[model samples]
Target: MRVRKLTFAALAVAAGLSLTACNGDDGTAQSDGSSSSSSSTSGGGSGSGGSEQGGGKDDSAGKSSAGSGSDAQAKAAKCRTDDLDITAKDSTIDGDDEGTVAVEFKNGGGRDCLLSGYAGVDLKTSEGDLSAERSGQESSPMVLKDGESVFFGVTYPLNESGGSGVKVSSLVITPPNETKSFSVEWPGAATLPVTDGSGSSVKVGPMGSAGQGGAS
Candidate 1:
């Protein structure tokens, strides 16, 4: 009876050891699975972040390219006459209608340009109606290179109705083969004094003013 009881106690001890070993193995497997799941989640998050960054860069590049294209189109659509710079020194002329008025033009562009014709002038009276003056066709073809200049002399007939100073309202410069028309205004012609003087003392009317002793 004593031996049988001893044998039963030994079997109980062995069963307890076996249970402990099985529990340890299960804990280690659970820990390893959890670690693997965490690593996978972190790796997936990193990959998504990288893709988002790359997509943002591509979008920015597309916008930049579109802007560049727009700018290029604007430059291409710009008229050649737009590049010309014209300045008149004393554009107003105060003289007998029988004489000529000279206008000087300077080209400020980097390339060459052509002047084809002038614009019509409209003369108005402060009190009544008057006829308009037409600028004659450009007699010779004029070309102005970069930093070059040319002078144009326009002559008109002096008549009795032209008295009280004529107003030169507008000057138009037309370029060859160009559809755009460039215009310069003479608002100062409104104040030109009428007198009979020659040489430098001769007072030229403002661009908006008529010749000496012409109708406003």
Candidate 2:
């Protein structure tokens, strides 16, 4: 009877040990599953943060591109005297005692420019130098592109009465807002006096875009 009691106790202890080993294996499997799940969640969070940071960099680059474009389209500059090619022509009407000379200012440079106001004129004569007066005409600013031209008028009374008058030999012209001057031969008839009597009645009109009118 004692031998049978010992065998039963050994069987009960063996069954208890097998149950404890199975419980330990189940706990280990559960812990491995939880660790894998936490690792996957951490990887997903890292990918999302990387995408947000990349998007912020792209936005900053776009803003920088827009600012550079604005700087490229800035305002234009004013015109200078070195950008022009000036010349003169006779524009007197037929059978009229009053004479007119059209002075054209052509833009010969590679860019656009602004031209306004009257051109200064001085007539070289045998008696003395005669300065032309402004005709008190209103003028607007003119924008001359490359190869474009603007005009102004010089009006004077002709010495058609065959009386003694001052003969103008040459013309000294100065562009508006400029200190330098240009001298050119008289464009009218060589023998004709440019003005009547003492030659103090010469006047210079305002700048114009058209060939006929003085200012427009």
Candidate 3:
């Protein structure tokens, strides 16, 4: 009977040890799962933060590109005659320089401007009153952007008559309806053409686009 009691006590002790072992293993598994879950959550948060930061940088770069485009457009904005450079050359070398002249208009300012329609042309003589003639084709204003130029043609005759078919020295030019005149250096040894059997000789054509034949 005593032996039986001893055996029973030993068995009870063994059952308690088995239960403790099982509980300890369960706790260890739970702890490991919790640690793994925490680590995964932290990594996900870091990835999300990195993605947001990268998005912000891309947005900043886009805005910078847009700003540069706007600045370029602003610099290409309107023009005036006072901010222009004017030049002239003889047309039709096959004939007397008295026939036609090619006039070039260039933008000499920091901004762009519009130039269209006919320009007022006149001849200044060393021996007589200035000859003024209003001439040009009626048209719309062409957009003359900064650093751009347009061309036109003018016709005049050479008169070496002993009377008043005056000799030209300088040219007086004006923009349409602006009344502002630009004096151009005349390098021709020709005389102004006689228009009405008199001493006025000047006719201007409308300005043409760049790369045009100067008369269009």
Candidate 4:
């Protein structure tokens, strides 16, 4: 019994010394552990926020680069007559009360080209060449790639008088200020009347955007 009591007393003294030793140390160790954990959390949050910000910046830069590329492409030289393939087709707007033919032009060259203002057109048949005047239309520069096409419209009042007027069978097309001209076949069998006691016969306009045909 005495030996058992001595053993219990020894155990109790050892436990007390352990608790005292823990209490004797400064609180720096505990604070440091908590600080380490806080630092880890703060670092994780900062890193995530930084990643999101960086991603946004990258997206903005990408769009800016795309815009710059488009601006560069928008700057191009005027179209050359030899590098274009022109076609004429029968079309009309505001009903069939008017006679209209659409001029579809494609850039067949290796480089981009620009076109503005009116297209110089002249209707040709066995009789003579009847030049078409401008229709006071305005347009901006249009850019086209190889094999890509743009179109314009040639509109005039339908003359049914059967009077003495120039009969048009074919069209001679020339790009603005270009010497070389392209020959476009007449789209319809109906003859184009140059003038039959009318004030004006035909008018030309600039080529519009790819999907929309414009005339003045």
List ranges where model 2 is wrong by over 4 Å: 1-76, 189-199, 209-216
lDDT of 2 by residue, 30-145 (tens): 99999999999787887889999999999999998988896766453455667778778877778867777888788887888777677789888777788899988898777778
True-structure RMSD, every candidate: 13.2, 5.4, 6.9, 10.2
Q: Show the colliding residue pairs in model 4.
A: none
The lDDT leader among the candidates is 2
Q: How well is each residue in 1-216 modelled by candidate 3, as lDDT tens digits?
A: 999999999999999999999999999999999999999978878788999999999999999898788565743333456888888776644556456667788888877776656777777775654654546456676778778778877766665555665567777778755678888877554665444656445666677722346322
- Residue 15 in candidate 3, Cα distance off native in Å: 61
Error at 196, model 4, angstroms:
6.0
TM accuracy, model 1? 0.38
For residue 182, what is the lDDT in candidate 4? Answer: 90
- How many residue pairs collide in each prediction? 21, 0, 4, 0
Our model 1 lands, by Cα RMSD against the true structure, at 13.2
Candidate number that wins on lDDT, 2 or 4: 2
TM-score of each: 0.38, 0.60, 0.52, 0.57
Clash count, candidate 1? 21
TM-score, model 4 to reference: 0.57
Rank by TM-score (best first)? 2, 4, 3, 1
Worst 10 residues of 1 by lDDT: 199-208
The C-alpha stretches of model 4 lying farther than 4 A from their native spots are 1-75, 162-165, 194-200, 209-216
